[model samples]
Target: MGEKTLEEISKAMRDIDITMLSTYAANGAIASRPMSNNRDVDYEGDSYFFTWENAHMVGEIENNQNVSLSYQGHKHFLIAAEGKAQVIRDKHAFKEHWNADLDKWFENGIDTPGVVMIRVDATRLHYWDGMDEGEIVLS
Candidate 1:
């Protein structure tokens, strides 16, 4: 097993629906929660997730933009991404990443009140497939 490229790692992540989003809490502790990408796994060193504006994670992100995302796929494939997160309240941006599956969470879709989107732009990506491991640093 040799080093894996971003495209190859992205392909492996296509089926991974959920990622553990980690943020820094106000108390200086690390907080983590499972956030579904809603199948928006196009890679490109960026990931998006929708949540309410009042959510704790939102505040955490506001306090510290540095965040991490962990993904696990079949066949012992695992990926970890370190990035900076931005909270987006723009409805147009929401619509861009919106999908039918998200309707279950946001009843009014992008029109839902207080809805915000978190965009994590990965600066570093590390992947491990069984005994093989590699890392990619995005510019």
Candidate 2:
């Protein structure tokens, strides 16, 4: 019923494991895919995801860092986050967010040859919970 604080938004995001990452493709079309957060929802306006270095998403990010992440939570809560995405290649940074569940997707875990991390630093977030709605702006 009021403004949503960053802490409150972060707390709500913990329960959301998947988000629809949207990007602008080179063909002048919007591309979107479901990306798992791996339960690393400490928030702070930054979200991370793992993908192959050669993936189309990586190419899209290279051409346009502007991206959006959409999350749906319990009780009809929804979040639409707009941010800039970066492709991280450093294994040391990967180690910080790596999890066992990802082993299913990337064989050899962090050692996987094409593994890359996508970091989205949110600039604006809009949320709706049933009839209540609010937005948060980050610097």
Candidate 3:
């Protein structure tokens, strides 16, 4: 097995927009949600996401660190990555992902009380249906 070059992974992320993050409850049922990509950390060591600690998704993440994210678009390409999400308490990063949309939920602006960021370190990524099909590439 070989590693996917940073450029390849970056291309895949740029070619796709949304990622479906799948998590679970203590009961073992599955839940999936569509989230916007950071667009800034495609091939970086970690992918960053913003979520409220009080949100339902945070509870699900606490129950299970293992997560699966899938990305697909009109380009007939699909990518699924298995990863572990960890909450980041760093204030600078939280402010970096913050936008006016976050103001809707956080009264204190980017430094809201319960605001959190999840950094996912993907261990495996499977891509298909792009310029190459049946290639079954892994990263």
Candidate 4:
């Protein structure tokens, strides 16, 4: 029934492990895929997801940096984030966001060749829960 702060929204996001990451496809169509957060969400208007360099989403992000992420949690909490994406290839950056859960996808973990990280810097976050809904703009 009241506006929510970024911190409060971040707290709600902790329980959300997967988010739908949407991007603009090369064919001018909107594409979306489920991305695991690996519970690495510290919020602060930023989110990260790892995928292979050759993945379709990577190509999509390359063509268009603008992206959106959708998240749903218990208690009717939902979030939609609009942001810009950067594809990171640096190993150091990989290590920073890497976790054991990712080993299931990347056989060698952070050392896995062709592994790339997509960093989404959210410029705006909109959320809804029950009868409450609000938006947070990040500068």
Candidate 5:
């Protein structure tokens, strides 16, 4: 099989719901948290999930682009990427990724202050599917 591209990775992301988000601090400490998809294919270019502008996870990415997002369904997979993340104060990107439930935190909906968008550029993938009795082939 040919190696997967970013679009392929983004498409594969549609197979799962939740993903583990990994970030780091200046001290080299790594942190991981469970994040939900705002929509089924939220990892796409317009994927929208909300985070406080002051969150440590947000700070780490701003400081360093090295990060990872992993998801598991009938198989396990991880996407390792490096990309800078800055607060997307623009209302357009926010609106594109916006979800109504976000109003709980952002009273103004997509116009809520301190809401940001994380733009991640995926670079690598380590994945394996062990959901069967043995190696099986399909045609």
Candidate 6:
């Protein structure tokens, strides 16, 4: 009904494993793709995703850190977040967030060539669920 804290929003987002990450392409068109959260949804106003350094998404982020993430869940629950994205290439940092499932994508694990982690530090998050709607600002 009213505003919710970061914890409450985080709880609601925990079940959401995938988010549509949106960025601006070289042509200035909006490009979006599904990004797995790896069940690391302890949302502390930040989110992380894994991708190859050579991916188009990585290039998009390099051109513009401004990005958005959209989440959809059961019962029509929805969330949208705007943030600045940072590309991380450190193996140690990647190790912290890496999981076994990622092996399916990177056979050599975090050491896989060009492996990179995208960290989004959200500045604002807005949510809606039928009659309940609110926003959280982290910046």
Worst 10 residues of 5 by lDDT: 130-139
**Model 3 per-residue lDDT tens digits across residues 1-139:** 3345656667768756578888886789888888766564456546777777887778888778988888785567666787888777788878766666656666887677887888778777766654553323334
Candidate 5 residue 56 C-alpha distance from true site, Å? 0.8
Clashing pairs in 3: none
- What is the C-alpha local distance difference test score of candidate 3? 0.71
| Local distance difference test values of all predictions, in order | 0.93, 0.95, 0.71, 0.93, 0.61, 0.93
lDDT (10s digit) by residue, model 4, range 35-136: 998899788988989999999999999899999999999988899999999999998998888999999999998889999999999999989998999899
Residue 114 lDDT, candidate 5, scale 0-100: 79
The residue-level lDDT of candidate 2 at 63 comes to: 92
What tens digits encode model 5's per-residue C-alpha lDDT throughout 1-139?
3354446556767776677778888899989887766654734333334677888888887788677766676455544333334456677877766767667778988666777777554444544444322111211
TM-score of each: 0.97, 0.97, 0.77, 0.97, 0.70, 0.96
Candidate 4 clashing pairs, residues 3+ apart or interchain: none
Q: Which candidate gets the maximum lDDT versus the true structure?
A: 2
Error of 6 at 56 (Å): 0.6
RMSD (Cα, Å) of candidate 6?
1.0
Candidate 6 segments exceeding 4 Å error: none
Per-residue lDDT, model 6, residue 131, is 79
TM-score of 1: 0.97
What is the TM-score of candidate 2? 0.97
| Model 4: lDDT to the true structure | 0.93
